[model samples]
Target: MTGPLITDWSAVSPYGIGRAAFEEGFRSGRTTSVPLENEDWLVGERADTEACLVPGFVIKEVLGKKGTRAMDRVTGLVVTTVGRLLDTTGGPLPSEDPDEDTALVLGTTHGSHKSMVDITRDTLTDEKPYYINTAHIPNAIGNASAGMCAIWYGLKGPNATIAAGRNSGIATLNYGRRLLATGRARTVLCGAAEEYTTDRSWLEWHTRGADETGTVLGEGCAMVQLRAPAADGRGDDDALAEVLGVSSGITGPDGVAAGLETVVGNALRRAGIGREEVWAVSASAPAGEAGRQELKALDALFGDLDPLTLGRPGQIGDTGAATSAFQVVATLTAAQDSARAAGRVAVLTSVDRDGALGCALLRMR
Candidate 1:
């Protein structure tokens, strides 16, 4: 069950607005966090925690001011990221009338908590229950970002959104795989997005108990262009990586490590690759309790192999829904640049605190 080939990718992250920025940040190996502002803290001590945010993301500069009046942060992040992909694949915008078989499947933790909270608070605190801006109400839902991409880009094919917390990278990739495998689409723009809003930052700090020794909350969107592999079984010389297989699982209480082992083993088996063949491991286990459980799971699977391990949370911060996708990007970049990592098989695994685990096997092409 080989998955669709990941032909290209683009991102808008804390580092900057494209793959170059992300790669530069990763190469520098510098911590990209800033002290949480007074209002940015809702649960943790300001001195002990920090946040990774895209420093000056202006929608008008990225997409112009036409439809931004009612756009939410999630929508802006997605549209801009997708726009960059389009810039590389074709032009900055889709053709006046492009293929209708193209699809979009985006993953997220939750779509724009700021929009949801803002709309909800407006309805409660306003003079009237309906006094909130009705025009932007649609932005409050989780699927709004995906739907907005279709509307803005004129992608008139299957459009969907999946929520699987940090495991969303493989979740969205698997869903997009179905769309391509079932012949429902010729191309898929698949990715995950998370915005570093005040509410989102506060929630991560409060819920995850993130501190100096834990995952720092970050924000960004990472998307890849996927399509059926060539019949000749050949990829472009510049292809980032070839997807072998992707699998996901959900665990009960105290089953996180076991669940991760199951999914990773399944993905490797389906790909017909042995554990010894894996040359690198991209793990999305942020620091703290969850990170410890993830490490335990990896040890169970690859303790003997001892592949090169890569984790970018400390550099990119925990990107929430975008963490695993950025991990994929990080993995590919490492495979591309590092002599030790180049032209090797890599396994990317992700685990979320809410019981979801996912793994994707990739081979540098």
Candidate 2:
């Protein structure tokens, strides 16, 4: 079956993401991080202890009068962002024809940590179950975040949640594109959101390993709407960017650089574009050697092509699985904003695990 095209996408980041605040941080090159001074890292075993969070979150918009007490802040982010995305896109969500197709999928590495950690604390201190657990339970199902999205939007068919460490978001897109291709759903909502608050310091400690430097945590959520092919030239209405192609893999024995060459080479071949044609690059890399490794690979793939870093993920810290997927979304948003008078094709690349990598080609419509 023919795959659907990504029609509309919107983002809600911690640093006032996708809005004026995020643009300021982006242009000024100012870091949104703070030293991990007052954080309680007693539970953090091996993770990097420091963190960077969005200074002010306009979360009250969603929880206006209801409050965020019912679920984790991260979970709230997922629902709120998707809701905003729907508001902005004005898609065919609750159409008169109930058969009108739509899909919802969310990617997250730390979905309910705020609640999970609270439950853990309670389990450690008392013989009774924690209230946080009770609160998070309804939305705590593995599919809770996406489930909330489906229920809120009344989306039917193929609603799923994805988790692959920092690569979950991109992976969700890969899977969702296929869902569209197979005709399981026509318009699809793809997203990734993560929450790493102070309470989940243990996760940070473990993730940091023996090192205490370069650890900063961030949380944000994003959603996208994918549109199917035009039938009688009616609904190809708002195709933002065609899913030209998707290719993912890890580097070979030589090094991370070699691994990326193989990944990008294959994707370029699939998209029928040349190396020199890619105009921008959105890298999904944290700080330290890992980020450099990504840069090394970028150099290898399009050594001479102009590349851009959305800044060090470590600076803003890792927002768990939602990092890379948001990276992809930001690049597309940036390219879309820049396409008014330019001829540029963008590349979104993400590297995870020992060599697991994902790359996609997006072009202006």
Best model number under TM-score = 1
Error of 2 at 36 (Å): 7.0
The stretch of ten residues in a row with the least summed lDDT in candidate 1 is 39-48
lDDT of 2: 0.64
Best by lDDT: 1
Q: TM-score for model 2?
A: 0.81
Over 4 Å off, model 2: 1-3, 17-28, 34-50, 58-61, 88-100, 128-133, 209-212, 231-237, 307-316, 336-344, 353-355
Q: Write the per-residue lDDT of candidate 2 for residues 219-242, one digit (tens) a residue.
A: 777677776677665666576666
Error of 1 at 151 (Å): 1.9
In model 1, which runs have C-alpha deviations exceeding 4 angstroms? 36-49, 88-95, 209-214, 340-343
Residue-level lDDT tens digits of model 1 in 24-90: 8877888878776643324433423467877677666667777787888878889888878877322
